[model samples]
Structure formats: structure tokens, C-alpha cells
Target: MNQHKKGLVVWIGIVLLLLAGALLAGPGDRVETVQETMRDAVLHNVNRISLLGLKEVNPGLISAFLVTIILLIAAALIRIFAVPRFRYIPGKLQLLLEQAVGLFDNMARGASPHRFRFVGAYIFAAGAFIFVGTLFELLGIQVVTVGGHPITLPAPLSDVNAAIALGTLSYLVILSGGVAANGVKGVGKTLKEFSLPISMSFRLFGALLSGLLVTELVYYYVNLSFVLPVVVGVLFTLLHAVIQTYVLTMLTSMYYGEVSEPSPPKPKKKKQASSPAEHA
Candidate 1:
């Protein structure tokens, strides 16, 4: 084999040996089922919600709140430091931000040519939230459970409630677009698709839940947990993040376009010359 091929083979063999050793030496622990792995435990009970009133402060909400704060701080820092430092040639971060803005703006325009102006920013914001929130779990930030067990915080969308909120919120944003573009007619048009929020919410929940469950299942087994957890978790998380972000953004943009579309004017009747008999 060539030198490069030999080096690659050596690395592969080393990795395989390490994996084998880890797997063989691992303690054989019983695996947790999908249901058990997927459930979010309470960190601590907070004030009453008054609506549902379960009492446990949702870890999903806490995670989402942290993500939101991170996003806001990043935005603020970018505006203060990055924006001011941007030069004529454009640095990496500035270029990336500009490109992202341009991409979402283009998608908004393509989805709703006439009414995109009303909802473009909303689409961009929603896309950002979904993408960031989906990958938040990879940060491995730990939160103490009410039972005193510390666990890595799960992504917000992995929680059904948070998924539902995001879905409903996206639908509302689309509705607002409709209202802005067509007023009462827009409202009526948006309300026509009553099942939208539920579907959206469930879809987000299902996709994220699938990824979470898969990763958890991988980690639940000692043998599989060796080097496989990292691979499985990352692949699932990245896959879900990209897929869900695109799906939600596309759906929102399409629906917004549909509701905001202006009705075509009816053709006017031709004012023909009077018939000869009528004139006579």
C-alpha cells in the first residue's frame, strides 16, 4: 500500500482495537426502553402556570430560555463588536451572518413574492431558533433534577410542549402575515387551515423525539455506549436539526405565501357598440 493508505489503515486498526477493548470491558447494564429514555424529568417545581398548573418547571423551557438568552447575547455582541469591526473585505463571521440573512431573505421572497416583506424577518427568526434549539443538547450543559440527579439538558423541541409552542407560534406568525397582507380576508384564510398548528407541533415533536430516543437507547446499553454513543447522538441530532429546520421554515413560508396572495381582479365586460337594430 501507498504511504497515505498505510497511515489510514493504521489509524483505522487503532480505533477498532480501542473500541473492542472498551466494549469488552464495559459493565453490562440493562438498557432503558424508548419511553423511559424519552420522558423529561422535573428539575424543580416553580410557580403555578394557572393554565395547566402541573407545578414542575419544565427543563425544556429552562433550556429554551437559556438558548434564547444565548441568541440575544450573541446578537448584541455581534451588533456591538462584529458589526463595528466589519471592514470592506468582510471578515468570516460578518460574511457568514450576511450570507445567512441573504439566504433566508431569498427563501422568504421565493415563498411569498408579494407578501414576503411582511414575514421575512419572522421566517428568519424562526429558522434560527429551530436550528440552534435543536443542537442545544450537544452543549452538554447539565441541570440538577428535583431528585438530585444531574443530567445533560435535552433540546427544547424534544419536549412535546415546547414543540407544540413552536409549531403554534409559527402558525401565528403565518396568520399575522396573512392579516398584514389581506386584513380580515387574511384572517379568514389563515383560520381556514385549523389543523395547521396541531400538525406542525406534532411533526416537530415526533422528529426530535425520534432522535432523542435513538440516542438514549444507544447510551442505555453498556456495550453499545463505548464509542457508539457519540456517533449515534451526533448523527441523530444533526440530522434532525437540519431536517426539522428546513421543514418548518418551508412550511411556514409556503402557508404565508398562500394566505397573503392577493385575489385576481375579475375581467371587465366589453362595452361593445349598440346593435344596429337597437340603434334603429
Candidate 2:
């Protein structure tokens, strides 16, 4: 079945990503002589490697920040115009976004109406993931300006860890909300909701992360070995964009449907009537 195949592919991708992250970020993966010499001359002051520390001295961090801002603005525009209205889709961008929105709406209808509120959060989280991925790639390109040297990024958390954390938390919230909204009757159904978000979010994060890591790994190994970087880079970036958009909108609709369920109506307020004499 298609669903089974999809699940298999996702799990395989997750495994590959874990291996890649461990290979690249493990304790023994220290900078070699060339990288150390370059850093010594250009970035000797860089002592610590925390997120905040990197941001203060690294141009890549500034670039990442700017790119994040741009992504947020684009996401805002998409949310405001494209998503809610379901407007026309002529260009490739609009067409792509329309497909994602359609999938998300289907998910929303299946979840609770109140859960629909979480569409915004999913959009934000997904967009953030994509922006981060693209920013890393762009920074890699920028490193070429300095004599085609390799540049390292300040990895916030391992891809596997992030995937697990993001997926588990998102699912728990969705499952809990759906269960509470449906009262005690649909406990089983609500419990089932947990896996959907978890799997969806994890699959997406793993795919994107794997794409990024693979690109960097390939470039590292085959920079001038007749392995065309442009083609490979473009391919991975394209895949990343498409996958991120799909995941973002799909999760949004899933959460939206969960939270969008209508609550039971309360008794109408009895408006005090005017005196009968005044009416007569």
C-alpha cells in the first residue's frame, strides 16, 4: 500500500539522518590543519561555540537572522492571503502552496475545530525549519569566497534529537486537546491522534535534515572530483523547499482540524423585557 511504503521510506530516511549526524558531529570530528589555520588567522577570537557566542562574531549568524526574518515575512503573507482565502494559483509558487493548503484543510476537517488554531504554530515551526536549512546551505556557499574553504555551522541540536522533541511535543498537545474537547467518550480516538502528528513532524524534519547533511557531506568529499556542486546543491535545496512546504501545511491542517471542533452551545441569555404597558 502507498501508506506502508511512505512509512518505510520515512523510517529509512530517519536512520540515515541519525548516522550522518553522528558521523559529522561526533567527538573525533575535529577541524583539520587547513581549517584550523584559516580560523586561527581569521577567527582566532572565537573561543566558545554556543549559539549566542557564535551569533556575536559570525557573519553566518547575521545572514541566518536576516534570512529568518525574510522567511517570517513570506510566511505571514502566505498565511494572510493564500491559505485562508484559497486564492488563484497560476505561478509555480502559488500552485505549490495551494497543494499544501488543500492537504492541510483535509487534515483540519479530520481534527477538532479548536485545534485549527494551531495551524499558525505549525506554519511557523515548519517555516523555521526550512529557513534554518536554507541558511546553512547559503552560508556554505559564502564560505567559498574565502579560498573555497569549508565552513562549520553552530548546530543547535542534533537532527534526531530535534525531530524527536518537536514531533513528540506537537503530538502530545494535539492528542490532549482532542481528547479533552471530545470529553471522555472518544478517548481511544484521541489517543490515536497522537501518532499522526508525531510521525508527520518527524518524517518532515528527518527528510529535510538528511537532505542538508547529505549535501554538505557530498560537497566535502567531492569538491573538485568532477561531482558538479551546482546541480547537486540545487537539487537538494529544491527538495528541501518542497518537503518543508508540504509538512508545514499538512501539520497545520491536522492541528487546525483538531482544535476547530465546535463547543456545545450554552443557554442563551434571557434579555430583560420592557414593561407590557410600554409595549401597549
Candidate 3:
């Protein structure tokens, strides 16, 4: 009972200290209004980046590139140093890799048994990209804009263009699976759901953008900025990362399954017996 009371008192003291600090800290210089801050968060034009002698590129594109490079490097390193060390008994790394691969493989097989191999590989790559890209924002990697303003690179999906490209790519994969399985019928089937790419693109964009906007809002205010931003930002980012990854992969697998389903063989027509009268 005494230990519990002591712990409670410690928490109370910490809270009081935080409150005092917040009170003592004066309001920060208001360089931008809340509206302006939010607007900047939503619009990439405000803080355009430069890449390959090109100006006005979105910062999210840089984030995407960085994430891609990171993944590639990690893949190469693992292939070089990790795969050869694997044992039949399975260590932590091997077990983790197996589980991750198995998850998408199982999902794909369950959804599209006829063509799970490609679907599994595609969704695994897509899921990894989405999951890693979303969490990349948490690293708070800052890049200088073309205008010399330093801004933190946002999640790739937070940019509509990245999200749209991914959605379109996933749709194309599904369409290809359909074409491979059912030919023209598959194309027609996939075409009928043309709005899928748009919906998927916006879904990813909106979810990631919401987290970005909220984090920006929290960080904009000086008083609320102390500890709240960390909690809000991490919770929102992690939640969105896991949720969006699962949602996209699951949807892709399900749709691919639907489109790639093999057509039932046409029933054989029963031949009518030759007319007995004509035969006679």
C-alpha cells in the first residue's frame, strides 16, 4: 500500500512539474497561423523539394525514395550476411522472416488459390512498402526545400500522387491476373471496377494525411507541444500504418482472387438422337 501511494505521489509531482514548465514557457514566435500551417501540410507546393536538377518535387517523393533505398540496402545485407547463417532449427531473424512471408502467402492462397504465387509476392512487397513508408515519418528526417526551408519528410502515402500510383499499380496487377486467367473476360471484369484505383488512392492518402495534419496541429501550439505531440503522433502513425497495410493487402488479394477465378467449363450439349422416321 505504501509503495502504491509513493508511485502515485511521484506521478503527481511529475505532472505538477510539467504544468509549471508549461506555465513558465512563453508562447513561441508565431511565424505562421494555424490555417497556414494546416494548408502547408495539405499542399506540397508550399515547400517543394529539388531532385536531379528538377525543382518543385514533392517532399513525399523524397521520403519514398529514401524508404525504397533503405529497403533495398537492408534486403541486400540480409541476403549476404543473414541467409547463409540460417539453420533448420530457426533463429529469431529467420523465424520472423518466415512468419512475415508465410502471412502474405497464406492470405494470398486463401483468397486466390488458383494464382496465389504472384498475388502473394505482390501483396508482400506492397504491404512492406506501405508499412515501412508510413513509419518512415516517425524518424523525423528533415530535408531542405528548394526555397531553403527545412521541412520534415512526410509519409509517402500522405502524398496523393504516391497513393494513387500504388493503387493504380495494384489494380493493374489484379487486371493482369485476370487477363492471365480469363483473357478478355478478365479485362472486362477488371474494367468494371475502374473506380477501385481512385478509391484506394484516396483512402491511403486521407488516412496518412489525417495523422500528419493532427501531428502538425499539436506541434504548432506551444503549450500542448511538450509531451502530447509524441503520444498523438506515434499512436496515429502506428495505427494508420498497421491498419492501412492490412486493408490494402487484403483488398488486393480479395479482388485479385475475384478477377482471376477460372471460368467453369461449358457444359457439353447432349446430341439429339437422329429422327427414327428419317433414318428408316
Candidate 4:
């Protein structure tokens, strides 16, 4: 009706036309499926660890261990170097560290208002791991396998076993909070969930793996590779990193609150009133 409305209508028609053209475009020579994307990687058995008569360990286990070590060393460096230099007037690094810590601390306090003391550090540690480990893969760091093939190390949570380990550890932290606040009753109550570890594990694994698979698909197809995979892959990784970090921390704190909260006492029934005639 108006000039502005006409412009909007023109834009919508242009977008729809582009979509139709793209859909009608003939199939490319290369085809990709989820299974093919997943199976093409040399992920699991690449660099097997053989130690002391043991059969062999998975490469993902090694990645998890390496990530843990890196986290520990970084923490130690910050404590030794950064803590000594902290001043009243905070700079960029100091401000960032304090803010990051404060965010999780606030989440912990908000979720478990009464029992944050027990789970604050646990939540912080888990959040840091998920956030940092996801980003670590973007470095494109490669490790050579025993079989002489080089493969980029994936985020530990990308591996099912490592995801299971991470989930189990978080569940244990929650269980410990319950036990601390409610005694033996806490452990039983936490265990009642029974499937928390498995659910957490698969949720994390699925999210990370889907991102990995999509990125792989983009790279696998030559037509889609130019400049697009970097954008798509980075976006997916960053989204999963932030999302999974928040999800796990939120769930851990919420469950800890449920398990640690003191059970409310039942109200007693009111006494029946006696009539004057009955009393006489």
C-alpha cells in the first residue's frame, strides 16, 4: 500500500525466490550422511595406550587426561603468577577472571541458596572444563597416532566414555552435597535419580557430536568448504560450549539444592473439640 510496505514485500519475494532456486538446484556429485560423517574420523582407536600388560586404552581417554592436566597447570599458573599481582584496581585479566568466577558463584548461590558452600567450587570447576575444553579443539592441535596418522584431538565430551566420566563426576559432587547436608539420607535421595549420569553423559555427547558431525559434513563436501566451514564450525562449537556449560552447572546446582534441602516436617492433626453435653 505504502512505499515502505512495498519495499518489505519486495525483500520477502526476493528471499522466497532465492530459497526456491536453492531447493530446485540439482544434487551435487558428492553425497554426505550422518553415519558417513561420523565414521570417517579416526577418533576412537587411533592412538592406543599400552601399559603394563593391560590390553589397550582409548585415544579419547588420553585426550581427557591431557585436558585435565592443562586445566590444572593453568590454575596453578594463575594462582602463583596472577594472585601475587592482584591489586585493588583490577585490570582486564583480573576483571575477566573475577567476573567469570562471580557468574558461577552467583548461579550457585541462586540455585542452592542455603547450601551453596558445598557445591560452588564443584559447579565452577565443571563449568570451566566444559567451556574451555570445547574451545581447545579450535586450536587445530594434532597428535600423531601409533599407526602413523595425525588426527586433531576432539573435546573430551565428544567421546562417549569421557562424557560418561564427566557426568559421573558431576553426579558424585551432587551426591556429596546431599550426604553432607542430609547425612546417609542424602546419598539415597541422590541415588534415586539413578539415571542422572547416563542422561547427562548422552546429552553432552550428543550435542558435541552433532556439532562435530555437521562441521565434518561441511568440510567433506568440496563445494561447501571455502570459508563457510570455518564460520559454521566456530559458531557451532562456541554455541555448544556456552550452552552445555550452563546446562550442566544449572542442573548440578538445582539437583544439589533438592538433595541438600532439609525435609519439611509433617503437620499434626488438630484435636477434636468436646461438646458441653458430652462432657456432662
**Per-residue alpha-carbon lDDT of candidate 4 for residues 12-129, written as tens digits (9 for 90 to 100):** 9996776566556644554335464467442565455543336555556666677788899989999999988998999898999899889889998999887997688888888988
Best by lDDT: 3
Question: Which is the better candidate, 3 or 4, if ranked by TM-score?
Answer: 3
Question: What's the residue-level lDDT of 264 in candidate 4?
Answer: 73
- Top candidate on TM-score is 3
The pairs that clash in candidate 4 are none
Please, what is the TM-score per model? 0.81, 0.48, 0.89, 0.77
lDDT of 3 by residue, 80-162 (tens): 99999999999999999999899999999999989999999999999999999999999999898887878899998888889
Per-candidate local distance difference test: 0.79, 0.53, 0.90, 0.79
lDDT of 1 by residue, 1-280 (tens): 6999999999999989888987788765433344554453211132112223454556677778888999999999999989988888988998999988887888889999988865678878878888899899888888765555566777888777888898999899889888888899899999999999999999998888777777766766656876677777787688778889889988999999999898677899999999999988
Select the stronger candidate by lDDT from 1 and 3. Answer: 3
Candidate 2 residue-wise lDDT, 1-280, digit = tens: 9999999999999967766775665344445544443443233234222345333334334334555666679889988876676645466677876555555554554543455545545654555555464545544433321333444542221244444555666566555555666655335555656567557656755565565555545544532223345555666676666666656555645664544354567899999999999899
User: Candidate 1: which pairs clash?
Assistant: none
The segments of candidate 1 whose C-alpha lies over 4 angstroms from its true place after superposition are 1-21, 24-35, 39-55, 266-280
Q: What lDDT is reached at residue 217 by model 1?
A: 67
Where does model 2 exceed 4 Å of error? 1-48, 53-115, 124-128, 131-136, 139-150, 154-158, 184-188, 193-198, 223-227, 255-280
State each candidate's clash count.
0, 20, 0, 0
